[model samples]
Target: MKDFDLVIRNGTIVTSSDIFSGDIGIKRGEIKELGRNLSERAEDVYDAKGKYIFPGGIDAHTHLDMPFGGTFSSDDFNTGTKAAAIGGTTTIVDFAVQPQGKTLNETIEMWREKADGNACIDYGLHLAITQMNDKTREEIPQVIRDGYSSFKVFMIYEGMMVDDLTFMEVLDIASENNGLISVHAENPFVIDYFTKKLLESGKTAPKYHEISRPAYCEGEATNRAISLAKMTNAPLYVVHCSCEESASEIKKAREEGFPIMGETCPQYLLLSRDNYEEEGFNGAKYVMSPPLRDKKNWNYLWKALNDGVLQTVATDHCPFFMKQKRMGLDDFTKIPNGAPGIELRMALMYSYGVDKGNISIEKFVQLTSTNVAKIFGLYPKKGSIVVGGDADLMIFDPEKKVKISKDILHENVDYTPYEELELKGYPVATFSRGELIAEDGEYIGSENRGEFIKRSGPKII
Candidate 1:
């Protein structure tokens, strides 16, 4: 019999802390040992020559088959998770929306049922609060106890936005329950008024989409959300933050020692408002909430990430086909408020951030995997490669080049906003729980391999 279950030999191991050349030995589904040439034999061995082995990516934000506008996103749990695995991600935390008037438990159960047998990697849920009341606020402690420690409260979306009173109440309860609150920071009322005026003036094209939801709307909401978090003494995470104004708001709060965090997506860092001005209805493909800002804001976002104002990078991978995007041809407000991005998030960030000298490789690991795991309470068990940690790893090839095209991606969406963009660096192999799920640009995992990760209480460290 082999002394070890498997051995990954002679690779540069990169973690959030350090980089070293060594071999990782696995037993069952956990990392049994990591060092140079251990005195052990294995049933299988992989020669990882000239590659970087890192912990599998954990995408903190994604939307699978989310219902928006008049149609649902094309990719469900199975296809989306498959795309994630191929891209070197082994875990995802998707939103479980509590529709207006529905109980949080019911919404969670519905989302759980949807992902039961369709996922290909480990998964978790973030509850989206659509309606906040005394009962909903009271349920925070129970939900926290039930292992959903993070909740998303929107500042935009007409039917879903919460008022100041409701927001304060929810924050108070979350604080008491040791939970973190993520805000979709955009002023819905301001956008609503502007949208009506723009449409009334015959500005119905996709270009008008960005014009309706200006940066100031996002800035104002960011400031308000930060104030609410301060008032309640609760930790806050601003999702998909765009523009310098919003980053400044978060920075100011952090400087004051508030527990405020920020996350930005690949779209805001790579794509810009120019994409919304494409000819005809093509611009609709890039239309998402708090739409991409001008080129100048990209530098500010990088600064925020470098300065520790922004803590995580996520995909917000919501999708709609080109045909579905046209649902709002006569009214930009009717278009779905999302874009397809699961497969391209990590590559785009690695190419632009790390390759361009904007961030260090260690920082990349933190923003992409470690911080996410820590915030959601998955820490050493799921985000690191130390002894006794889960053996979820990826073999990264820095020399590999890829050109973006929706036709080749696993997402069911019809078009991708980054279609012609070329990227360097890609993941050649991905493993989840010691099982090889993707290799050589192909996915090999079967459905239902994913298990729900129920969060425990707050971190003791």
Candidate 2:
């Protein structure tokens, strides 16, 4: 019998906390060894002579075919996970939203069916709690025990927003179950007031979307979420935080020993308000909630990432075509509140982050994979390349260069927020559980092969 099924040799292995050159041996879809080459028979061997081997990315946030704003997101699990594989992301934790009056379990099952036979890689789910009724509260602990340990609550949306009282209740209940609560932190009233004012003044341009949801809208809500966490002793995640005000609030909370964390995205790190002012309808393509802020905010966010103030980076990967985005040509609110980037995240973070010296290679792995796994309860099983760990790995060509354009990506969306952005460094090959799925931006994997990751309760690092 062969000692190992496959061996990836001679690459710089970068993990969350260490970087070294070695070889990784795989067998039975798990990493079986990590050391200098040994004389062992194998079914296959890959020579990664001048590359880097890291844990495949884990995009903890993405929306695949999620119905919103009168239309479903363009990329379903089929296309989204394919895109993720091609981009070297081996796992995704998409959020499953609950419709009002629906049971929490029902929402999870509905999303499970959607992704069951479609996902090309492994996946987990974060239950988006839209209702806070007695039954929903009563079911929280059981749901956590059932492996859906992380849940999201929005602070700003019609028919979705949970009031402060409800937010507190969620925090308290989630705490009791050791569940983590991620908040979409934004003050709805402030946004509504400004949105109405902008409409009245005929300032209905896409730029008004940013103006209406200013940094303070997120900052105020971030602080409020932190307060609830403190009072309930619950871990809080401020999702899609885009500005200095919100980052500052989260930073203060963490410094004060509160279990508060912040998550930002490539859009906030790279793009800014200027995109909303792009000529004509181009602006609508970047119209995600808590819209991009001034470029200055990007500076603060990068600093936060490097300084450990922010713990995770994810793409709220929802896509809408230009035709779909055009639905709001006369009114910004009608446009779907998202942009596509599921397949572009790892490349951008590696090229733009590690190559530019904005962050170290090990830190990049943490921001993209390991930290996410630890927080959401998939640590050694999903994030690291170690003995007895799943063989979710990526072989990256450090010298390879890639240019971002929707034409080259696998996402079903028509346009990309990072279109025309060129970057150095790309993943040449990706493996999910020892299975070679994608290489050189093309997928060779079968759909519906992904299994749902039933996670444990919060393990906040």
Q: In every candidate, how many clashes are there?
A: 0, 1
Task: Kindly list the per-residue Cα lDDT of model 2 for residues 1-461, writing each as its tens digit.
Answer: 88888888888999998989988889999999899874265678888889999999999999998988889999999989999999989999999999888999999889999999889999999998887888998899999988999999999878788998888988899888899999999999999899999999898778888999989988998888898889888889888889998999989988898888878999999998999889997899989998999999978898999888999899999999889999999998888899998888898998889999899998999999999999899988999888999999988988897777778888897788898999898989999999889988899976679999899976776
Report the lDDT of model 1 for residue 385: 83
Which window of 10 residues has the lowest lDDT sum in candidate 1? 452-461
Tell me the whole-model lDDT of each prediction, alpha carbons only: 0.86, 0.90
lDDT per residue as tens, model 1, 195-281: 899989999998888999899999999999999989888888899998897989999998888888889988999889999878888
Model 1, position 125, has a per-residue lDDT of 90
- RMSD in Å for model 2: 1.0
Off by over 4 Å in 1: 457-461
Residue pairs clashing, model 2: 117-448
| lDDT for position 120 in model 2 | 90
Q: What TM-score would each prediction reach against the true structure?
A: 0.97, 0.98
